[model samples]
Target chain A: MQKIINGKAYVLGDNIDTDQIIPAEHLVYSLSDPQESKKYGQFALSGVPRERAGLPDGGVPFITDGNYESEYSIIIGGSNFGCGSSREHAPFALQKAGVKVVVAESYARIFYRNAVDGGFIVPLETTEILKTALKTGDAIEINLNTLKLTNQSDGQTYTLVHPGDVLPIIEAGGLFQYARKAGMIEG
Target chain B: MPMTITEKILAKASGRDAVKPGENIWLNVDTLMTHDVCGPPTIQIWKDEFGGQAKIWDKQKLVIFPDHYIFTNDPHANRNVSILRQFAQEHQLPNYYDVGGERYKGVCHIALAEEGFNRPGTVLIGTDSHTCTAGAFGLFATGVGNTDAAFILGTGKIWEKVPESMKFIFEGEKPEYLTAKDFILQILGDITTDGATYRAMEFDGRAVYDLNIDERMTLTNMAVEAGGMNGIIAADARTEAYINERSSQPYTVFKSDADAGYHSVYEYKASELEPVVAQPHSPDNRAVVRKVQGRKITKAYIGSCTGGKMADFVAAARILKDREVKVPTFVVPASTAVARQLKEDKVNGKTIHQILSDAGCVIAPSSCAACLGGPADTIGRSVDKDVVISTTNRNFPGRMGSKQAEVYLASPLTVAASAVNGVITDPRDAMG
Candidate 1:
């Protein structure tokens, strides 16, 4: 795992639910089939515009034209990110779509746990000021060791509250890896 | 130090005398539940990560229920169940509930209670977010993802952080029109959807304790809607009686300390609360029923872990005894036990199922039939541009089917009234 992550940031508003991240209709793909799992990346953010209320023209699809994988690596979001559904596919889709870190004002409890246990993405809890300070396509640098995020575009720095106890699991690449290291599993 | 009920349960699970909020502990889980929707994937992960030689940590503690998307004829959904059936047989699990079998249960949450897995003073985890519903039994229960569930499958333990507690006190006399659904919607409206993020919602006060076991489950079931880590109520005589009727398992009951620390406390007058509806797109978009009345609806649904209990049906049946539903209405029981109760229990010399059927309501199979918007064949699904009023949680676009269809969330009484009127109408006006 890299201590410093630099990527283009994508911005979204409040209450991004699991359904918006990946709709239930697309969840039929078997996790056992690697060929079908690739389709999940394309469906990431497919239902966002429809579920979110009061957005212009049904809101802009965050992953435009299914090119988010190469275009963006970080998502900056408002409060209640991943607010509904306990589907791990939500974070898995984001991870498959090339999202490495999610900086949100807050997260729904289940989604936060899924993201950490799957080691799909780094869920960073930051202040609301970051929601306003960062914009789409902004160059952002995050230091996992220092819990500091720097907006290279605006020369602003924000401190994120470190999520305790789970840091070791994230550092070990996921819960399974951490379990193996802790002698909790036969691996 | 005095500890909240959640803290005490977590401390005990982690083998400590006491623990505080924000501290991490590894919990030895008592039960792990998974349904058809998430079970196949969890099993796949379990095999992929743990290899073929690994066995489940405990066969009795791991329960599998194939409820959602099972009634439909979709082959993919059927395949998911087949995978679960094979896994259960191979693992020799004792708690697998297959569809159309003698041991089958409808919804996992309600089945957990009826089967006595919701014992107090324990830690339970499920694959569904509504797993918090089990917390009503005076335990610490919450939802975990498929990966975490897989970890538990192999190790029988999970890592968790102790969450801060928020106390909500509902006082005053209960009104005739108000149900537990109404009380929770009021709290959601006041707190917003994410108001209690990363915290435990400890429900107490006169009105909550006065509620029956099923109603208490309703309150805890929707706790996840408010971003609560878990919603809990202390187990009392009501809990004991409810459990004793289902199972005679010995259990330990825990209570919160009077001086336990809470992040915040909210007090509400129960009598003052009105029948409310969560408008389109979000549960937090709540308004009083009178304000949104007369909005035409194409369908009305009363089912799911939240509102498909026997009490909810009784409330709806009271309003629709002789009245015919103007729009399509679906009556689904939460579990097979509830469905059986509906068939056996009489209201006004007729079974509640008969009343609902005579009222032109489609009595669908007891499962999460249309709540999660199952296959195209699922009954009561909202089609293109249809406006629906439902008693299920979540009104997100396409939640019940088509994105163009609008959904208004309400209580069973409100839904019945609206169904009879072909529009959103307050139950009081309909009763009058």
Candidate 2:
């Protein structure tokens, strides 16, 4: 919560569902095993069509072959991002791929909840459509305290929708940690 | 203040006399459903969070089904199923339905009804988006991810924001060719995928109540396609009858007041809406069958939680009877019971199964085969830019296997009609 978040941005179109995030076929890998779970990172965002894989410039890979980590650590998406399936693996894959935050116009309810509760990525809302203004590999930085995002590529700063009700949970690092700190769960 | 059925149900669960939209409350869940793909991950998180003190809040209220990735040969998929089996055995859960066993059920949503767990005026959370399918029975049901499900598994409680309800009224005598699938597709086309995000969709009107339980499920199952939190219907006599025959648990029945508030209301004449399909890559990309006819397809699929029920097959049989399909058509039942019914029931003296088989449709084992593009070897999965018209709920890129393939989401009647001609066809052409 004290750290400033910044990374290269990977952009995508609207309705990028869980299937496009992790795909059902690769859901078999173990999330608990370190070696096996890294496969989730390797396959992250592999299901997106080649034409929309990386926005502004299409077909740029999220993770190059033989690598489990992604170069871009922030994703810019249009409205209804993560619009299908309720798989927490979708968010987990993003986290595993080194993504620290996602700026999107809107989100499907379950995906938004999963991202916050699992402490995978910070899903910030943008009053402006970030996907169209940003290109893949643009450097971005997030202000942890004010939840502000600024694109270093264009020097354009965007205001995020106040994290409001779930801000405490995100700041505490996730629901489990939040509950522990709030004494909602017994240690 | 007046409230809709969804508001009433949430109010009762949250221990309030009345509640309004946008209020946050913790609901005491009545049941938690999980399937093979999500169950193992949920249990792992529960164990990790609680350590040795890990425990299920209510074993009887937790239902596990090894449905997804079942009937697959992939090692990783098999390992996932084993994880669920071990967890169920360790927990001694009464509701776990094992794969390759007598108690096995194909899909968790439909099986929830068959096992008498979908009681009215209850809150049910699950790890699959289609859990909203049970809202057809007049309950509060919605999908959650593994983390929220794990939290519920330990505490049997989860906080939810009350959602403003959208009302859809389908009027007029229900048309023979126009089923609930047609109306839902029409709604999707009009509203787009995110129209009802974080909200409730309540189905009403004469045509809605006129639908049987199976067909009613079809209408509610796709509510998630619109990003709805849940889809609900007020419990009428038909709903009560369906519940009474399956469950004997004492449950409260709640309804919306005549003055209940709604975010928006849409009225449609059921007779006027024609069969339509959500053409490739998006569920809301709808096109009328008449307008899209003669678009060639490589495959026709009839199955999934949304489209693989007995009523769906019955509709398909109505078109495929005494006819042959020109393209490769695959039939997958949503549940094992539905599969058994296809053999036991008859359409014009020939079994529905027989009619489908004679019509050159390949029938796969009951489970979520090829619907979500499961294992690499899943039956009937698309390949090589294959154009498929399927009855499943989703058609997102790579959802049914090949990234290069195109999928069109349609009702069973339209799928069957298209199957006969190897192209998208107006269902009316196949009707008597």
| Number of the top-ranking candidate, with TM-score as the measure | 2
lDDT of each: 0.88, 0.92
What DockQ does every candidate get? 0.65, 0.89
Per-residue CA lDDT of model 2 for B280-371, tens digit only, reads 88999999998899999999999999999999999999999999999999999999999999999986789999999999999998898899
How well does candidate 2 reproduce the true complex, by DockQ?
0.89
lDDT of 1 by residue, B1-432 (tens): 999999999999999999999888899999999999899999888888999666788998899999888777788888889988998888778899988878889999999999999999989999999999999999988998999999999889998888999999999877878889998898899999998888999999889999988889989999999999999998999998888888676678999999999999999999888999999989989999999999999999999999999989998998999889999999989999999999999986999999999999999888988887778888787789999999999987778878788999998989999999999999998774
TM-score of chain B taken alone, every candidate: 0.98, 0.99
Looking at candidate 1, what is the lDDT of residue A172? 89
Best by DockQ: 2
lDDT of candidate 2 over A1-71, digit per residue (tens): 74588899999999999999999999999999999999999999999999998988799999999999999
TM-score of each: 0.95, 0.99
